[model samples]
Target chain A: MIHFNDVTKIYNSNVKAIENMNFTVEEGELVIMLGPSGCGKTTLLRMVNQLESITKGDIMLNGKSVWHSNKIEMRRNIGYVIQSNGLFPNMNIEDNAMIVPNLLGWDRKKMRDRFNMLMELVGLNPDEYRKRYPHELSGGQQQRVGVARALAADPPVMLMDEPFGALDPIIRTHLQEEFLQIQKELKKTILFVSHDIDEAVKMADKIALLKGGKMMQYAEPARMLNKPANSFVAEFVGQDRVLKSMSLYTVRDLANALTLKPVIESPDSQNINENLSLRVAISKILNQEADQLIVENDNGTRKGSITLDLIEQFLHREIKESV
Target chain B: MCSGGDLIVNLIEYFVSNFTFILGYTWDHIKLVGLAIIIAIVIGVPLGIYCSVNKYAASTILQIASIMMTIPSLALFGIMIPVLSLINEGIGTLPAIIALVLYSQLPIIRNTYTAINNVDPDIRDAANGIGLTTFQRLIKVELPNAMPLIMAGIRTATVLNIGVGAIATLIGAGGLGGIIYQGILRTNNTMILAGAIAVAVLALIADLFLRLIENLFTPKGVKK
Candidate 1:
């Protein structure tokens, strides 16, 4: 657990980088600090790893203050990643992934195994790209290696400062999805900073909205999007706020609410996973010319059917509830 | 002006007779320039890294190096003689070496400073973001990225030093310059040709040696 208690940062005596900020990131939770430029989101994320020293108050890691701890040891326990994907150019992909592990003096064989596994996890082939340098890979590939490097030492906490901000839209979404899958197993407590509201909505378990270094509101993705704290947050979340909200709730939520038909009719190749969004299910039903689509559980067992009418009612119900 | 056939025969005769004489002078020239360049690097590179971090010092140091560069090689040698006299190590290879070291400083210092500072800020951010210590960043990341340009600077300094070294004989230091000086005083054409040729050959060898070192040490990722 990470906690910030009345933190403030004053630069050159007068300029304030952060002001009286306080928050907590619980264990195994991915909390996104979201705002525009100069919002001190990066500063807040950095304070967890002690990259930015707290000018006032205290930042507690596992209930202990960071200021008194050995800075290097504190940082080593927290994996750090940045937008540029700071893989060392001199080291090959393999060595880059293992740099932190090596620094921590993990046994050589264990590090080697972790390197290969991380490479595969990040969609890179260990055998083909292990010996290659950062420049040898494309921007997306380099970012993958950067992510792999951050995850190498298996730290319990990760501090990411716009880690995917540099990638193109498609690659960013792909990485975000892959990262979600990775997080399921890793279950690391992550503090991510992002200027993009879409990225925060997609990746955050809890969103802390900030403006002028102040926490405007902290809520789950759906609540933050649908019921914003104020005008500033509403405007910041932008248009299609309802769509963003609808996307956050799963088809399973909608399907479970509806009466289930145990029978499967007109077997179709396109089957929807129960965990998918209502938006995707609606589109799939229309594209396949089916009034209702099959919904499968985690084990690929047909759990129920989701019809387009139910999707429409769900949207209407949300609109009514918001009003 | 001899015919082509006569020129070749003369070249062969010159080589056959003066091989040992030429070889000894060439070795002296290499040692003189090599030591000077190495000492320059030992001093200049640290100065460069220091300057890159401290802006006030960077401008001051670069200004001093530029001023040093403006001094004529012979004039610098003349200044060094008295300075060395204070230490009682005057008037020969020592003075010549002192002159070359001063001459080499501009390239080595300027290049090291520029190379280190020229490393991408984003890369440096990543290095620090990932928690490598300051020294670790310099040795592992900053140095590797700066090396291609730094090596280029070293190559420039080495070649320029070797060429300037042909004048080392002016201070009574034995080198190809001695043969050239003797030939000039005695009006011996064979000695002049041998001296000029041997210096030219030594320069090519030195240039080749440095270039190979540069290629070997430079990180392949940063190479063009």
Candidate 2:
């Protein structure tokens, strides 16, 4: 768990990067600090690792004050990834992954074991990638190494600052999916920073929307999308709240809403699963080859039917609410 | 043909007779160049790092060094003769060493400062974020990354020092250049060629050795 109590950061001559911020993240939860450029989101993420010192209040990790702990030890216990994928150019991928373990003075065997395991975890093959220099890898691959390097020491807390921001859109989406899978298995407390609202909605369990050094809203992604706390958040979230909200509503949400009285089967039924969006369901309905859309329960039972009119009504209502 | 044969024999005999002296003189020249390089690096590198860390100090020190570099070597030595005579009247190896040290300082200082300062700010920030102390970062990351440029500077200093050190014989400092000066007074072209060739070879060998060392230590990513 991490807790921030009235934390503030003032730059060289009183330019406030962040002002009197307070928040907490539970263990195994992914909290994203979402905001515009220069909105103090990155500053807040950096403070978790003490990369940016706080001028005013206390930041505690796992019930201890971060400032009071030995900084090197604290850093070793927290995984940090930056936008540029900060792998040391002087080191091969294997050596980069081994850095923290080497710093902790682990034995040779332990280091190699940890290195191999992390390489696999981040989707890099140990034999093919371990000896390659960072420049030889693509941007997405380098970012994976950056993430793997951070995870090598198996820290309980991970802080990522726009780790996928530099990748192409396709690679970014792939990496985001891989990262979500990793986070689910690792169950590490994660604080991510990104300026993209869609990325925040897709990746964050809780989103902290910040603007002008102040946090405008901190809530679940669905709530933030359905109802922004202020005009700044709404505007920053852009004109696509309903579409962004689709990321939060899994096919499961739609399935849960189904009445279950009638069963409808179609040839394209597999296209709609527990993870399809409402927009996808609306498309499936408009195709009109089938009378009703089948909704399945978590256990794969045919829960109920979602009519074309019902999905259309939901989309219309969402669009009206967003306006 | 007989005259040429006789000249070759005479040359070989002369070389055999002075074999030990020639060997000892060459060894001493090597020692002088080596010592001067070590001293220059010891004094210049840290000074460069300090200057890079502090803005005003770097500007002042570089300005002074640049002014010193503009002074002709012979005149600088001539001016130093009186000043250095106050400490020791006999003009010898010490004055020569001091002059070469000055000549070598600029490249080492400038390259070290530039290399450390030019390292990617993101890399440095990553080092800090990873919790390396200032000293650790300097020793492990900054120094290693900056080394190729620093070594290039040192290489320039080494070759320059040897070339300059050869001129020391004019002031009674003994080295292989003593042979050249003696040859000049006697108008002996053979001896002059021998000295010049030896100095050239010494500079080339030193350069090749440093290049090998640089290659051995340079990180693969920065190797272009």
Give Cα-based local distance difference scores for all models.
0.85, 0.83
Q: TM-score for each prediction?
A: 0.91, 0.89
Cα lDDT of model 2 by residue, B1-224, tens digit: 24767656655665688778777777878887788788989999998899878989998888777787787877766776888899884378777777778888898899899999988888888888887788878876788788899999999999988888788777666788887888899887666756776788889999999999989888887675
lDDT of 2 by residue, A1-323 (tens): 99989998989967999989999999999999988788998888888888878898999999999889998889889998999988888888888888888888999999988888888988989989988988899999999999998898889999999999999999999999999999989999999998888888888989999988998999887778778888888888888786678666666665555434366555644334556676666656677655666776557776666776666566565545544
Instruction: Score residue B103 of candidate 2 by CA lDDT.
Output: 84
Tens digit of per-residue lDDT, candidate 1, span A1-323:
88889999888999888889888999999999998899889988877777777889898887879878888777777888888887778788888888888878889889888988998898989999988888889889998898888888888888888889999999999999999999988899899999888888888999999888889988888887778879999999987787777777788888666665544676563577888987677767778667667778899998777676677787777656654
> What stretches of model 1 exceed 4 Å from their correct place?
A260-271, A284-309, A316-323, B1-12
- RMSD value for candidate 1: 2.9
Q: Under CAPRI classification, how is model 2 graded?
A: medium
Q: After superposition, how far is residue B105 of candidate 2 from its true place, in Å?
A: 1.4
